[model samples]
Target: MKLVLAIAPDRFRDEELFVPQKAFADAGVETVIASTKTGTCEGMLGGAAEATTTFVEVAPEAYDGIVIAGGIGSQDFLWGNNDLIRLVQTFAKDGKVVAAICLSPVVLARAGVLKGKSATVFNSPASVSEIRRGGATLTDRDVVVDGKVVTANGPFASKAFAASVLSVLSPISP
Candidate 1:
């Protein structure tokens, strides 16, 4: 079975994490949630989930892909995290699927992987500026897939974003 590592801020978006996790589960893929620190993570919408490990503990070579869950906290916690950025870079270097939704795509932009890639993020002047600075072409689509990197606008596109990740990681679409 394929395995994926999901990295989220302590305050991740509830749907961004849960929706993709469920889709991966139903497709027979295993997912492990990680954060800057392990243990409980609260969602922006008040939902809670446990992070099985910390980002520093993850080995990029062991997983088929990486998914970044987004929320308001993502701006404060994830955007400039060096460890998470390294993980994203490792995944991209290894040609693994790299995905992010909402504001979290800025992490990919900050990691310098979104350069020249067409991707979408929750439209905000800040986010659009960041991605464009990193050389990405901003799009208005709900979900944009460029190579193995997938990006979505927000919670509304969570299901489709997860499906897109699955299709990239698996032979069959979920």
Candidate 2:
């Protein structure tokens, strides 16, 4: 399956983007990296990724899942982005997997897709408040999955978060 991975132009957590991306690649899933603009996106810790397209270029129907990578830039660039928000909402409405890691969950919350859902974000008062205000039941767990929506608390939870998303994309039989 193909997926869209959104990151801010700057300050997206390095592992939050790379780890899950590696998982998807290993599973043979195609991913398109998107940011506010096309080109390179820098991470908080000096890692960089080339954004294959701009957020506006994303077509929700073309992908099986959407993952928003987070960091301080998420608040600066993604929090109020209407297009990104609409993409999240559209993926949810279409029953596609929607996942976010670290502070990125706030984007999903703000998009109104987290309402009445159980989610977890980085343990920051502001992050917690954003999810709660959006009507989500906040969890302190490392990872939380509510239907097609999956959330991870912070950088440390990257692996578990990616696994949760992969499970949704390709479920394992008993």
Candidate 3:
């Protein structure tokens, strides 16, 4: 079975985490939820998720890929997180699937993995500027896949983003 790491901020968008995680489960892929700290992390819409580990505790080599869920808290907590950025870089360097939804795509951009790659993120001036600064060619689409990097625009694209991540992970079961 394939293994994926799902990272979310304390106030992540509910659907962005739950939707893709359910899709990964249904596909027989194992997912481990991680955050800045371990414990119960609340979602933007009153949902709660227990983070099994912290970003610093994860060993990138143990998983096939990673999924970053985005929301308002992401800007405060994840956008400039050096640990998460290093993890994203490790995943990309290893050629593993690196995926993000909504505002979290900026995390990948900051990691320098999206340079010259076509990607999309929640349409905001800050997000657009950061991705461009990282050398990404932004596109007007719900989900954009550039090699192993998958980026989605917002919570609405969670399911499709999950499917795209699945497609990129090797040896996935139907």
Best by lDDT: 2
Which lDDT tens digits does candidate 2 get at residues 23-88? Answer: 999989999999999998999999999998988989887889899998999999998999999999
Q: What lDDT tens digits, residue by residue, belong to model 1 across residues 5-53?
A: 4555566889999999999999998888888888888898888888888
How large an RMSD does model 1 have?
2.7
Error of 3 at 173 (Å): 15
Q: Is candidate 1 or candidate 3 better by lDDT?
A: 3
TM-score winner, 1 or 2: 2
Better of 1 and 2 by lDDT: 2
Model 1 residue runs over 4 Å out of place are 3-9, 171-174
RMSD per candidate (Å) reads 2.7, 2.6, 2.2
Tens-digit lDDT string for candidate 3 (1-174): 455455565779999999989999999898899899888999999999999888998998778888999998888889999999999999899888999999999999999999999999999999999999999999999999889999999998988998998888885233
- Using TM-score as the measure, which candidate wins? 2
Backbone clashes per model, in order?
0, 0, 0
TM-score of 1: 0.94
Reference-based TM-score of each model = 0.94, 0.96, 0.95
